[model samples]
Target: MQRHSLSVSELTEPDVVRRALDALCREVDGEAAVAKTALRKRSAFSEVLGAAVGKGYFAENPLARVKWQAPGVSEEVDPACVPNPTQVACLLTAVGRQRGRGPHLEAFFGCMYYAAMRPAEVIHLQISQCHLPKSGWGMFNLSGGVVTAGKEWTDDGAVHEVDSLKR
Candidate 1:
């Protein structure tokens, strides 16, 4: 069998680095895939590049030395998506009216909108964690959340995987 792999010289080339950055900015699978590739993706690629430097494969990270303009992206949230207090109240009332899971999901949505909780955090919330005071503000701990990474990725062969809160 024949094997093909990129050599260290080919990997650190200017064209290869530019191609990767271009891919990050370009749409994939007919959808605009977002990436702050430097910060997000756990900086895995950067770490790899650093390893290359340590191994004397390169003098420096080629991507850092080069200057390129990424596509303009708005970081602000659109005002149209936000609901007013009155609208939120109306929505809550309507949610309570629906049958079965609606009543349960209303509180879930409240945690998302009011507390700005992630869905995973809401799902793993335990009643014991809540300190519901008689009058004033109550409190709860958000230690972690469960993620569904599918059976293939989990040790127990179950879909749900418990993980620490995101940074």
Candidate 2:
């Protein structure tokens, strides 16, 4: 009775692979999920299959041979969604008008808009990094940032993860 479940050969079979792909397609259909989100899941799975191929466990990644079609990903940026400089300034001022921490948050949002810093990068920015000048220009020395990567992937089981600036 215990020997029936072991069938590693079936993993590479075309029919079995197709059936699994079909099931995955059906399961993730609808529910407000985007095509990119679903494709990312497949890509993550492909990495594991790639490792199996490297270890000589298989001829190649099963995913590489399988004919699975992912939905089209749009790379274009919509100009209509982008706010003008004046619009951004006004929005920042409006946030400052709010009670309590709103005024403090305006500068935080400003750095994201003007300096092009990510939310995580802005959060970790310290006063020591600032090169604030009285006149012309100033700069910041950004070394690293923190982001949310979910608790399961982190060593401390915390949702936030620290990462160096990319690019």
Candidate 3:
């Protein structure tokens, strides 16, 4: 719920509020299937709590006082999951061979390799955004890109939608 309209003076006591926050943390912990899941949720919850306190809905953020420790989990990206140079080349070759593939796809891969563009940015590219010179090699205008929330696609996730490349 939005915190702007909430009034701490009319709400429950500070101790009661603290206890409620504690209960919510416990509930989140219990429902979370993984430590990372719990950690992420708690992090966002803490932000909301902070906002509530800032709006004078509460004297202090109870979440600030509580110590949250997430259990250890592997944070490292798996080496096997990453594509080697040869694999990448083969994939690129395959993408190049697809029938009726537009120049955009080739340019997109070029951006991925040369400009180190993320996939979302490549997909959102427009033809008019590129700056191919009349004499020299072309250059891509990648001032915009898409980003997913929490490493997965969601309906409510934000995407950088650009109508035109910036001049």
- Highest lDDT scorer: 2
> For model 3, how does the per-residue alpha-carbon lDDT over 102-151 read when each residue is reduced to its tens digit?
44566568678766767777777678878878887777776665544542
Sort the predicted structures by lDDT, highest score first.
Answer: 2, 1, 3
Measured by C-alpha RMSD in angstroms, how accurate is candidate 3?
Answer: 9.8
Best by TM-score: 1
Candidate 2 least-lDDT 10 residues? 24-33
Better of 2 and 3 by lDDT: 2
TM-score of each predicted structure versus truth: 0.65, 0.56, 0.42
C-alpha RMSD values across all candidates: 5.8, 6.5, 9.8
Q: What's the residue-level lDDT of 138 in candidate 3?
A: 79
Once superposed on the true structure, which residue ranges of model 2 sit more than 4 Å away at CA? 1-74, 149-153, 157-159
Candidate lDDT scores, in order, read: 0.76, 0.78, 0.62
Q: Report the lDDT of model 2 for residue 35.
A: 67
Judging by TM-score, tell me the better candidate of 2 and 3: 2
